[model samples]
Target: MNGLDEAVAASGSDVISASAGSLRERFEAAFMPNYGVPPLVPVRGEGCHVWDADGRRYLDLIAGIAVSSLGHGHPALVEAVSRQVATLAHTSNLFVNEPEVLLAERLLGLLKAPGRVFLANSGTEANECALKLAIKHGTATGRTYFVAAENGFHGRTLGALSLTGKPSIRDQFGPFPLDVRFVPYGDADALRQAVTEDCAAVFLEPTQGEAGVVPPPAGYFAAAREICDATGALLVLDEIQSAIGRTGHWFAHQHDGITPDVLTLAKGLGGGMPIGACVGFGESGTIFAKGDHGSTFGGNPVSSAAALAVLDTIERDGLLENVRTVGARLAAAVDAVDHPLLARVRGRGLWLAAVLTTDAAAAVQAEAQRAGFLVNAVQPDAVRIAPPLVITAEQADSFVAALPGILTEASA
Candidate 1:
């Protein structure tokens, strides 16, 4: 057997089989049980600390897969949601709510986009909105076809799924929407060849967040912009996992200095609350008219208020600067770990990961958890680190201090 497979098998034996039995049993009984047995049954969280059902506390580094930007149950979020619920919670799209309008304005002011916002409840829903907008643009301009990158992940909805290049997600979910093409990510020539005048849009992820936090090389995004402009295809960036200060910037794509025709956001926007949006830019802004696309609970007052609180706290608390400092220190620490088990470190800001020598990512994840820290094995050989933006230097130090021991345990 391969070295990675053998290590993975060895690591699996060390997992505490009934570590979270109470919550696991409850989950199996209550939920549809679709997820592959949850990692931990977290009961509460504060700052970067999470307590599981058995009262085990671990320093959180995953940040709910880059969703919980401010960390769990921040006072601002709690107050915002509480106040919003006590005031006005849910009003249909037929009516304009104050928080929704305010959130739209706030988000647009920060984003490089020009057009209006269509809010949704999740990243997938946000991508669905972008797809609808793309369809509207295509129909009006007599264009079809979409170009997406290999290893790209947009969302799970049929249309968004069609744009996603992962065969594991698409192979079973046919027959999908047609006219979608795939090309190697970060390859300007591949993108240029894939996009044509007939294509409606080209979807991309700034850093390919789920693809092991893979950042494109220099000029890749610029090249994409050039191709999209040359072919009359709108450029759409899926910032669902890389936006909302997760990467020490409003969006990871900002580092590339290129703006997209449309952008989808969700993961960290609401700071643990469910909210998403599809924002259009330039001529692509005015594509949506009335009744073209809408969502019921998309911009519900509570969620919008939660987003407002998150934005307020990020600005007032200066968490972005904190993320920059802590992320750099942590990245450097990982690089200096000097373990044969790790290949290298990748990503920018706080969205980083350690590529492994062997495909023992899951083993490493378990070992880290046992070592009183939490991380994610997003890819077989990569462990993604997307800690809360509020993570402090001390917390970053704690994680780094534990890495060698965790790596040793994982490798064993």
Candidate 2:
């Protein structure tokens, strides 16, 4: 069977909108208009394909901002979530739950690092948890100032926002929570100078997923680790957008062999079920200290089960290997393009981004959508490409073949 057919069979039966225009109009009228009108009101999706209200199909490349690891309706996710919700949707943090314990165990084992886990509802929650851990670590030592890399994004919450380095996101939200120092990313000397004993943690992103999918220079993560070590500060790596096979590794830091003391993960962890986790290693791993930190919906049975399913699928389907192969092809395909707007392509595994010379990310995204393809302007001159790990080589080729024309049209 073809990829689309296989995907639908695995997920719930196909679901398409009755009328995209009607749905869009209705959504415009009802929604709070916070996100400024979604590109389209997607009613149904299977694997890497989403059908609009008008029965038009488009190849998905963003993968719900790297949240849909197994794609829209994989059998594993559907079955796991269905079974989990039926059995137990949520049990407050007051009691110990089996699925939550099991999922934490699974994560600890996969991490191959000694640590404790704090679960939450989203990447931002995970970041908030990590920040809490760092704060506690600092409180115990009588220090709390933090160091975050420039262009780095942690979460939107006040605590996590204290560690975020994005100017625009933080501009209106401040004055921020507490002491946070922003240093130039990939600059080891800057980091060394910035991090002090008073610093609770050093927060960074292995690959800046929201910063136009920017990958740090070689040895940057290692240097950050060393700086954190020297300063006795916990290193927090925000892998929300890069973790769980998005970069063909359990965590993107694995590529650099540099594991952070605290790693914040979400996005694809529950395969779009809205789950977040903060895994701390050794001392950093055990700093929660009872009532100092907790979450009501974190580590709920159903979400934990769904995360387990996503992990199982990643292993069973050998999606990481697929990522290595197909991702290389996608990079080459995008690089082969001949266009003035096209500058370069960068990223790892299924999480690729096409860099353009002009700041026409929005126009290119629109053109791609019009051409029956899906992409996003994750940054001013970059369109992030993070398709589902289950995406076939043929699908990658299809996007590549259509990209040049899309670029040409957009540049025109």
Candidate 3:
């Protein structure tokens, strides 16, 4: 038997093939319908491109929702994961691990702030950790309310969802445990009004990723810092989709010249491996004493090694500068498309969204896929482009050049 057949037989499963229909059918049967049915079944990837089960190749612009920082099959990530797994694959919080400690130290060093790190498996978990810490701090200070921005997204878990401002998903979840106040995103005055002494924490995304890569207005974050300081509220910046060179800086809040008391990171940190971190600064860091929180697979060696490799590669390749230069070029080229369907572009660095004149972003996304490129319709009128940080000038230009035609096809 061949390798595929051997694996299937060993698992005692029915035969499977690389055909898209078969794989998708199996996927639906074996998995929950939360994400619905995926449009394409990608079988292989390399650099900035991925091949579907049917053997069609396309430029991967979304990069797994901005998680694949160094793109697919990066040698450094592969080597590190392989070496670490071979040496030591996992060590629960019961024992110490080198990669986990190093990863925490490296992240704190990048922030240039004193803090303690809580490792987790996903962005939602990271936010959950932040939420717990905030609540502990608030409870100690006799605060009961939390503040977030409308149209902002944190995560879907109970604690994180409580801070999420998107009504569509949050409302269905019903009354959350935390009392949260919603404010208009990018409105400093509104934020100031919402965040008072009663507020325990203010959760904000430096750039709203799910709201179509929307960036806050200039001076907004700086004003937020002042407000939080005045109110004695903790500022929590969720950079799950914007950190690790997805933006031009190490962290998106840095662009606004402000530092959040608590920060959450994931997505791009592990370069496709599952990992997340919640960092609490100053007194907030001390709220969680021993036995306050823990995780089993949170900081396993494989994922920590992968995160380290991603960080190392980002610095070694100068991907931060690359993101700035190429992102500017892509934004300008997208705006210069001269297509009537094109409205404008939003976001900074590699995280960008093309806002369409009409609510045809889904159609445009489909057309881009047909034309050998992958993009995300983050909203009815916004197509998101968050390619690998290593995407080149030519690669970005190719997408821009094809966008006009794609928009025309989508409009038709």
Candidate 4:
């Protein structure tokens, strides 16, 4: 036998066996190395819990990087996707579908504003659509420059990656589309200085999710709106990670009582199905004419149906209110622990981060995994926690209770 076959035969009985090391070896041999080595092989999931290939269950706090809004294996999601796929799966963009129309209307109603929606298959595609709209909107006025905030993450596509401020991810991919300037996040004064009549759009996030859930300063969005209005630049909010009840609201910007000219959404929008939206408000909605943009699998019936089910379940089950209450309890519990290794807790609703006093977040994450929990060390000193919106106060408290021990062990 060849070396690879010999190794496989020596390692296990079957390829799908519950050995993470063997699975990881096979994965590395087969897939590209972009994601590096995955630490766990999750075989099944339900609600706020997931079971690994080894049959080890973990309290899933990250929830697929805040994408699993209704959590895993939700019956509503299953039913909607199953029903839609069985009925009519794909008609491309040539013909419209009921689920697509219904989802668009529902999204607009939730925004409580008049707008037009362009559906896509992911957050990056949604941002690409929004950027195209912004550029087109500026065409009538000769505005071509775009502004975004440093430390803000939009997406990884060429257009969206240009708007992202992290140099580590961006520096390697240039020469990108030009004329994009980045200002400090939460610094309205800097944003005011940067925006001008020549600027086409200013992209930002209500809270910097990938930047360890850092929230903006108070009244920052209000100030940003005023500045954009004065400068005649479109204000676009990237709500991909913070929207769809992840932040205890339909959209995180609602907390600031400001309406952006354009909004991009994805992540938890479809519970687990891939879907995204670029919504334009008022005059901004009319910027796109025919042939400006299009996507083949943009708003397919199955994904739209899944999104509809997620929205319905969130409302029917009162998951938004649950997020608010349980999120507060979780944050407060972290504060109550007051561990010496913990610096502070940042973020809102179920989306939170335990900022560490030392750069031991990776160790803490490893320790937490060993303790039967899943958390993300988003930075050297920050561990992000975004449980499913349906997570209970009791479940949150369980994590909170385990955190002190986890931190203690990590520190040691």
Which ten residues in a row are the worst by lDDT in model 4? 1-10
Give the C-alpha lDDT of model 1. Answer: 0.87
Task: Give per-residue CA lDDT, model 4, range 4-112, as digits (tens).
Answer: 3365467775644648888988899999999999798986688899988787999999989899999998989989999999999998899999999999999999999
Name model 4 segments beyond 4 Å from true. Answer: 1-18
| All candidates: TM-score | 0.94, 0.95, 0.96, 0.95
Model 3 poorest 10 in a row by lDDT: 8-17
TM-score of 4: 0.95
Most accurate candidate by TM-score: 3
RMSD of each: 7.8, 3.0, 2.7, 5.0
Q: Name the candidate, 2 or 3, with the larger lDDT value.
A: 3
* Model 1 worst lDDT run, 10 consecutive residues: 10-19
Q: Of the candidates numbered 1 and 4, which has the greater lDDT value?
A: 4
Backbone Cα, N, C clashes tallied per candidate: 0, 1, 0, 0
Q: Which stretches of candidate 1 lie over 4 Å from their true place?
A: 1-19
lDDT of 2 by residue, 262-350 (tens): 99999999888989999999988778766888788998888899999999999998999998899998998898898899999999989
RMSD of 3: 2.7
Instruction: Supply candidate 1's per-residue lDDT for 404.
Output: 88
TM-score of 2: 0.95
